[model samples]
Target: MKIHINQLEEGCILAKDILSASNKVLAYKKTIVTEHIKHALKAFLVNEVHVENLLEDGRGFLPSGIQKEASNEEKEKVELTPVKTFHQLYNHAVMERKQLFTGWQSGTQIEIAKVRQIILPLISELKHQEGEILKLYQYCKKEDYLSHHSVSVALLSAFLAKRLGYDQGEINQIAITGLLCDCGMARISPVILTKKVTLTEREYLDLKQHPVHSYNLLKSIMSLKEGVKMGVLQHHERMDGSGYPLGVKGDQAHPYSKIVALADTYQAMVSERPYRSKQSPFKVLEQIMQHDFGRFELNAVNELKKAVIKFSAGTKVKLSNGLKAEIVFVDEQFPTRPIVKIEKTGDITSLKDKKELYIQEIF
Candidate 1:
């Protein structure tokens, strides 16, 4: 049977090959109709729908407005690269983590170097498509905390480094730094890592010391450079000198460290933490932008804003009204209220320009 993509979950079957028809999709699969899939499908269909609100049964659907229809030639030009499934990304992260962390000793420089080497290429792969990282963040599941967030942060850090115009060598080093930045957590007691209850003051202090713990573990690795070691040490440092292991401030903090700090916070906020649910990516980005510039470099924040906007537009999202819509454009300066087109009617509405609705999250 045919189905809308929003209706399909993790294991649903594709009914048929998705093909372009005259004005509408003809041989599309059940997998092709999802709200998320539809946005990507637009690169193929070139047809964008506008979101709308109707007073009928409270069911959200698109309200028709100005219709910018897709052309056959445009459809032919669009190559819908089969989006790699998030589960596949998740599984890869999980396998890699297990392989690297198992039988590990504290200060196993050889093992750490090997892990860094293996992960650098993957980070580079993701950096080239930073937009994909944003998309993957939207699709991430909550349960697999370790693998998913680790890869996401690495990809994010790599993307940030690239945006800053770091050469390939620097990007690889930073990416490797990000991937292994949290390796110290592996040394902490699992109970503390996944603790359900609030920690005692002593436990809190211990947790905050992870960065130093991380640095100590990495200092012996002859293969790692000063930048890489500094990355692990300063990833948590805030611009205001509130960060741990050393409240190193301003230019004293390495640029790669700054990028990792921003990436780590953004990924952590968007990914599910043990104590809290994941915040929406848009919300997380906005929050970071709003914070005092000293906490994160202004230039880094600006670059991050670009990465968020690139992959975020045309993605399926949940709005404050609980209606589903596709992001149409981003207000680069505003960062939070993006222009969205409601799914049913294909109207281009701006959340910032129009005051009626606000975005809740990427679904």
Candidate 2:
């Protein structure tokens, strides 16, 4: 089937490929269309179709293109870095929660210790890997998502804080704030937590209340500082006053809140959710950049962006042409395309230098 990449200003259309929410179809006609589709599919997959207007594209159109394949060697060069240990940790968190909820006679201290052992060292290295942190965290699946999300955000936050030139204490605090950001969710009902359907308005309201829940939970932990508590409470608040729990805007929000917001949004976008599969980290960064100036602090956003690029070194990715390759290194200035090693004929392609090549997504 013929495919077009422009329809509603930024989504894509498929000719022969089947269109379904469950499938990993990433093309969109307009950027908005793609975002809309993502939101809709998540809602659809979870049966959260109450927002009827959501699926309606303001400028609906179809775009199509031909499918292409990369050389066999190219495919071999692109591999998902194993997140095996992290995956197990995330799974353990879920299992721990389940056993706790089910009233099973406790028995997972070793697992918790294992997770801590892995996480502590990873957190230590997090500050150096801005871009690659998301890639490393993508190994999570649905069951372990929330657990993975908390850990991923902590890692990213630590890295981002260091990049912004925060001292070690400040960096560690950022990581701690991120690690405990969602601790309040442990108090929420499992019925809402494990639901496969889209959240109802009431459910969303409850979910929004989680920041407060988180704040309260942290209050019991005496080791947390005022800034850390504030970060837990206000991380969801937006600069535009559009976020929830408390509608504080701009400078009213704490510095930690701003940092947490960036880390949270970035982590969520790259991690799979009940409603939608994760998008490419590059795409997530692009979206973040699009909103950076107005919705987020400028320096923080730029620093986080730099961290992500640096972390993506030696990662394999799929290009727009369906070719697979490994990223040798990324240019700080030009992030979308970096120096890549294409498996096909061992050609070295640079996004800056390659005239016809474009990165479709980073796997």
Candidate 3:
């Protein structure tokens, strides 16, 4: 019944309580071992735990990680599959998320295994390639906005976590936190979800309770890390107590929650909506620093800044005035506005001096 944390897979039932080093109960016995349990066990430094021989569905158990050796054909088949581009992966994840959200709306229980299969490979590819993923907002359409939003937030959050120096395990959990932060919205009316017009005050209020709904959905999965569950619940909460559901502020919000909140806000601002046009992430980041100060964690904000401002000499870009240019120099102090040589006249312009212009895209 006892097994290591990395060996955890969905449907494994806990046979004993999960306790901290201080012997404080973290999760009670009879809980399901699934979802973010690996991260939680690593976070707690719990080496192993007792589990039921049969899975939660009463099926016989064989540890998934303890699989038989793969045949050469199986390995060849995996290698033969064409690698997906970042956009391709993003689109696939969005479709998968849409189906999952629909199921959640219909009151189906979440299967953590499916969630992992949907996201983990996509996450791995992005992290490995550092691909042109930030501009995924450009691909968004009104009809698929919800699913697109979830996938974007997950990618951005994972990038920010890496920039913030989290270990791989913690970063993975944060990515899931981003992906599921809005899962509670499934419980909201479909009319509200797909509405073209502004929500009524009452409808808006109902929409705001999504964090609580998301928390409720995730809270019952005992093997999931508490921080991840709390992260989903508090994604809308602000550090300054201006956010909704619980209005929790400062350290009262989980760090993962803060990361999700930051990614969610950034992605929402950049992705076009039915009501508002998208803005440049540079503009949004500047606004967050100058105006939305105290509402977000500064480290998360800085990591996002670093991620977005990364540019080098000779990188091609588009300016706000619609001219294509090539980066000539990037001042670390003035990262958002890099100096470039305009393709039209070969005129070198220091973006810092052109207050009205900013780099729109790096092609």
Model number with the top TM-score: 3
| Candidate 3 lDDT by residue in tens digits, 77-185 | 2212343467777788899999999999999987777777677777777765574556768878878889999988988888888888899899889988889899999
Task: Output the number of the lDDT-best candidate.
Answer: 3
Q: What lDDT tens digits, residue by residue, belong to model 2 across residues 254-344?
A: 8888898988988888777767777777767766776555787678888867766766788778886889988898887777668999868
In candidate 3, residue 185 scores what lDDT?
Answer: 91
Output the lDDT of residue 41, model 3. Answer: 60
TM-score for each predicted model, relative to the true structure: 0.70, 0.62, 0.75
- What lDDT does each candidate get? 0.67, 0.63, 0.79
Q: Residue 115 lDDT in model 3?
A: 74
Score candidate 1 by lDDT: 0.67
RMSD of each: 15.7, 22.9, 11.9
In angstroms, give how far residue 70 of model 1 lies from its true place: 46
In terms of lDDT, which candidate is stronger, 1 or 3?
Answer: 3
- Model with the higher TM-score, candidate 1 or 3: 3
